[model samples]
Target: MMLAELVTTADRVGATSSRLDKTDALAELLARADPSELPALMGLLLASPRQGRLGVGWRGLTALDITHADDPLLSVGDVDAVLDVLAATSGSGSAAARTGILVDLAARATASEWDFLVRAMLGELRTGALSGVLLDAIARASDRPAAVVRRAAMLSGDLGETARIALTGTAEDLESVGLQVGRPVLPMLAATAATTTAALEITGEASVEYKLDGARIQVHRQGDDVGVYTRSLADITHRVPELVEVVRALPVNDVILDGETLSLDEDGGPRPFQETMSRFGAEVSRDLVLRPWFFDVLHVDGRDLLDEPLSVRLAELERVAGDWRMPGLVTADPEAAERLSRDALAAGHEGVVVKAIDAPYAAGRRGKSWVKVKPVLTFDLVVLGAEWGSGRRRGWLSNLHLGARDPEGEFGDPGGFVMVGKTFKGLTDELLKWQTEHFPEHESHRTASTVFLRPEIVVEIAIDGVQRSPRYPGGLALRFARVKGYRDDKSPGEADTIQALRALLRG
Candidate 1:
């Protein structure tokens, strides 16, 4: 297939708001893709490369000076070969060589094709359907069950490879994909709820486990060999040697465990998230040892438990993890679940997760089987500025720069606002239209991509909490911030203070 075909299909996917239309567009490509080129084509459509990061950023793209071709002639294999060379470049004068290669490739693409290529390299192909939509597309093209396709993709931890197999092979081949030790499978995700009581209401007679503000880890061990991966299945076994040692100590020789790891202070309490991240990011943090807390076990003693209930997994986990298991209780009563949640909070943990006892592990997707309940703090903050949107949000103001009141010039000019962070979530199309129409009326200044607004509009923002940060002058920033709604009746002086957010970092 030509590169133009994929680019044009991506344009159609982005232009439509209908999910069915997006699935159809993707199905057409998957049905026509050659078996040999399926993996590379799927990677491009997903805006990620099988070779990982190409070491090229927006700055490198801006340095290129080339005229685009009037027509598209680059084949899928040609683009794949070019990206392979780009990924292999390293050290010395590789940056200049990368620029030359990019220029040559850019000169072979049309203007629209060039725009799509830039987004693809930037990993921001905003097609409405990625994993979920593409899963259906694969099933449609292969005449297979969606459930079987999802399981194959999740267990293999590679949607592109799964597409190639499903497209070229039989249903038996898809079913052959199973849990393998030392090969990380996608970790199961959780949905959020307002409280443990609410979460329990959804999943009755569930296990309520303590939720930690740390990193998700999937530990795969087979005898003497063990591999640790992050939520996205990136191998980080080298960074967490302590964790590797802990997993190796497990009595079982073959096991795959899902858990969380975080650094602790001298008092044995969980440390700040930033401190944990600081240690996790380092290749070696000898001073800070990360401790692992297993929550769910997928395989044990050469027996697969992914299709089993949480009760069965818990039995195996208790036998292996012992004291390392996440603290939790099994209860059918909402009141008991609430008590456990309160205990978790009293112990300085974030919250408790309520999970169905009979549900199978649905990997790589956020299913309703497990629900995470964390307390959210809402504040009326001022909108300092907003940048131009992309993909589906194009031609509108998005990614709002949030600020809190600074009455005494604690951070910015006196009486000015101090920025906490930016958020582009929780906005509907109507809200986007309203902001585009009214934000310019209050624009104090403008840039190529952003419009600075007067500190007059108050917006309600929700956050998990605040954390210590050197990026903002306020000495703290919001964690997982999202816009709740515009506070039309609130004044700038009535907005929440920076001290209010800073106080969250303590509690």
Candidate 2:
């Protein structure tokens, strides 16, 4: 297929607001795609290259000198071949090598094709379609159930390859895809609940496992060979040799264990999250020792247990993981759930995940099958600024710049506020309209992307916790901050103090 065809379809997809419309457009395009080129085409449609990060980011792309072509002539094969060359280039001379390849492609591609390619490479294509929508489109094009395709894609962790198989192969072929010991399947996610009572009401009898504020690790093992992957599926097997040793000692020969790992202090309590994140990011000799706590077992000794219920999976996990298992209990009562939550907190854990006892693992997506209960701290924070939204939220002032009051000027000017973090979560269209209409009245300054507001609007913000940060003046930032509501009753003076937030850090 011509690259322009995909580029034009992406433009159309971006222009539409309806998900069904996006799915329909993608399905139409996929229906016309050649079987031989389906994998590459699927990758482009998803705005991520099959090549994976090609060594050139937005900086490298912006530095190149380009001669834009007037005509569209690049084919799927042509672009994929160029990506191959770009991916092959490495070492000290790789930058210039990548620039040369991109310049040549730019010279041969039309303006629209160049735009699409740039967006795809930078991971900024606002095509209004990604895994979920594109998965539906693949299902629609192949005349298969979306569930079947979703399962295959989630199991494989490669949507492009999953689409290729679903479109080109039969029902039996799609069914043949299952849990592999080495490849990382998407980790099952949990939804948030307001209270333990609400979570228990939703899940009935459940296993309320202690939720750790640490890095997520999915361990895949076959005999002695083990690979540890992050939540995003980046293999970090070599980064933690101690962790590999722990997994290697597990009784089962072939296993995939889903768990969390955190560096522990001398008291055996978890260190501050930044310490763990720093260790997760760096591949170096470690100061703090990271302890692994297994919560779920997706596979054991060549037996795939992903489709098994939580009760069954827990039994399998107990048989293999032993004492390394995450601490939890089985109960339907909310008070017991609350007591377990308190026990977790008392034991120096963040919170607890309340999971449905009968629920099977749903990978790569958030669903109501599992609910996480945590103490939510809310504060009346001053609105510092906001940036323009995108796609469905386009034209609205979204992603608010939040601030905590610094009345004593510990970190800044007296009576001023400190910029903590930004959030666009829990916003409705009504709230978006209100912000667009209301924030302009208090606008102190403006930028290409942000409308800086005078510190007058007191908005209530909810957050899981605070993290030590160097980015903001307060030396602290809100973790998982979200909008609760605008606090019309509060003043800037009454807003939450930086000292108060920093205190949360000490706790």
Model 2 lDDT tens row, 59-133:
567666777888888998799889988988998988888888999998899878987998777555656575778
By summed lDDT, the worst window of 10 consecutive residues in model 2 runs over: 407-416
Candidate 1: where are CA atoms >4 Å away? 377-507
TM-score of 1: 0.76
Please provide TM-scores, in order, for all candidate models, with all chains considered together: 0.76, 0.76
Which lDDT value does model 2 have at 273?
59
Note the Cα lDDT for every prediction shown: 0.84, 0.83
Per-residue CA lDDT of candidate 1, range 107-191, in tens? 9988888888887776556565556778888888888899999999999998888999899988899989988888789878777
Model 1, residue 333: displacement in angstroms?
3.4
- Segments of candidate 2 deviating more than 4 angstroms: 377-507
Supply candidate 2's per-residue lDDT for 196. Answer: 82
